[model samples]
Target: MIEIQNRAGVERARVTGRVVGNMLQALRTRCRVGTNLLEIDEWARLMILEAGARSCYVDYAPGFGRGPFGHVICTAVNDAVLHGRPRDLRLADGDLLTLDLAVIVDGIAADAAISFIVGAVRDPEDMRMIETTERALAAAIEIAAPGARLGDLSHAIGEVLAGAGYPINLEFGGHGIGSTMHQGPHVANDGRPGRGYRLRPGLLLALEPWVMADTDRLVTDPDDGWTLRSATGCRTAHTEHTIAITETGAEILTLPGR
Candidate 1:
């Protein structure tokens, strides 16, 4: 279902987006070597409660995943990418970790993700992967203006990933988000321009661009039934931001710190 927030609803969406962005930033800063995934989840829970917000993932139980996510945040390390269920493992230095979060505030929802190295040792490949996804996300956002077609955004994202020599995966991508966590107008990471749904004012979209280092294939973790890892065990990275379409252009609601 696609939702176009009214003026008042858009105001609420901005609040939710800001909260989501701040929470994710705090989580990123707190994550480091020796940090346990479970601890991170707990931190998320605390932050959400403190903000008087609601988690969109805690009770998520899509067909592919196990019943009830039962966690506050997604902590994907190294090879793990999307839907990363928090575990007991502690992060190690140089481990690439991706934190994906979605939450609702004042009846509006916003989603975002960020990937970064856990500690000091800067692996060139890991940094490159992270940079690639970030650039792709920026490109996609730049093209997400009112009246712009969804394909334009997807094409912009694909150009960055392809130019950076990373394979694009279509299995999962961005989507419309508002009152609910996930909604329609599926935004793929790669697509032909001038196609797909046209953008309009008051529309909200969570634009994410993720890629694996070597291949586009993914393998779901059997134990937890939530973490999605690279089939080739290659390091991966993801970058996302929730945006709202306005009369003139796009407003990036999930940008941290103004």
Candidate 2:
């Protein structure tokens, strides 16, 4: 369901968004070589609980994923893109990691994701992929204000990814988010500017732009039934943020502590 938040609802969303942002930031800071993926999930769980927030992932049972995600955050490494269930894998010196998280505060939910390299080792390709997704996300946000069509945002993101020479995947993309984790008006990475839903005030959308280095196709991991990997096993990166549409412009709610 698509939800348009009122002033009060927006306030609640802001609070939830901050919680999610802070948790992701903290996790990002503590992540490094030798750190286990499950440990990152545990750290996120503790932070969410400390903030008195509810995890949107743990206990999440969506049709696309195996029931009950049972984790607070997604730890996607290298070839893994979305719905990456935390496991017992440890990070290496140059592992490209992505953390995707969502939480609810005062009944409002916010979602965001970040990708980075572990223990820094000059990998130009990895840095480029990470930077491209972030740029795409920023582009989408720049065009996300009242009167802008959903396609405008998608096209803005798509241009960056496509121009960067990465393949775009449509199976999983951004979505409307407020009061729940996922909602309607699916926002694909690539689209025509004049098509689809129109932007309006108080509508919160999780704008994510992800890409596989070599292919647009994805293959679900057989072991966990949740993780989405590049069909060709190529590297990937994803970036996302929750934004609220407003009267004059768009407000990025998922920014870390001012």
Candidate 3:
């Protein structure tokens, strides 16, 4: 379902987006080398509840995932990328960690994700991969505006990832988001410009750009049935933001703050 929020709905969306952004920022600051993934999830849960927001992940049982997620945040480590269920293991130094979160406040939902190294990262390759996704996400956002085609956003993201030599995965990408976490107007990471859905004001989208270091193929983890990892066990990085289309351009709602 593609939803265009009215002024009141947009205001609610902004509130929800702000909450999600603030929580993510706090979680990022709290995550350290010695922290456990499950601990991160608990912290996120408490923060969301304190903010009077509801998690979009917990109790979510989608077809792709084999469960009610039962967690507040996705804690992806190293080769793992999407739908990474939090575990009991502690984060080691230099581990590439990705946190994906979505929450709803006043019936408006917002989502975002970030990837960073746990401690002192000596691997240049990991840093490069992390940088590439962030750059691609920024590129994609730059092209998002009223009257723009969905393909334009995808093309912008793909160009950066491809130029960086990182393999792109199309299985899971961005999507329209408003009252619900996942909605219509599917936005892929790679496509031809001037095609697909046309953009309009008040349309909210969760634009994410993720890439695997060595391969594009993703394998689902057998143990958890949710965590997606690179087939070759190579490292990966992902970055995302929730934005609302305005009359002139896109307004990023999930940014950490002023």
TM-scores of all predicted structures: 0.98, 0.98, 0.98
| lDDT at residue 186 of model 3 (Cα atoms) | 91
Q: Can you give the lDDT of residue 196 in candidate 2?
A: 87
Taken over the whole model, the C-alpha lDDT of each candidate is: 0.92, 0.92, 0.92
Give the true-structure RMSD of model 1. 0.8
Model 2, span 168-256: residue lDDT tens: 88778899998889998899999999888888899999999999999999999999989999999988899999999999879999999
Where does candidate 2 stray beyond 4 Å? none
The 10 consecutive residues of candidate 2 with the worst lDDT sum are: 115-124
Clashing pairs in 3: none
C-alpha lDDT of residue 208 in model 1: 94
Candidate 2 deviates by what RMSD?
Answer: 0.8
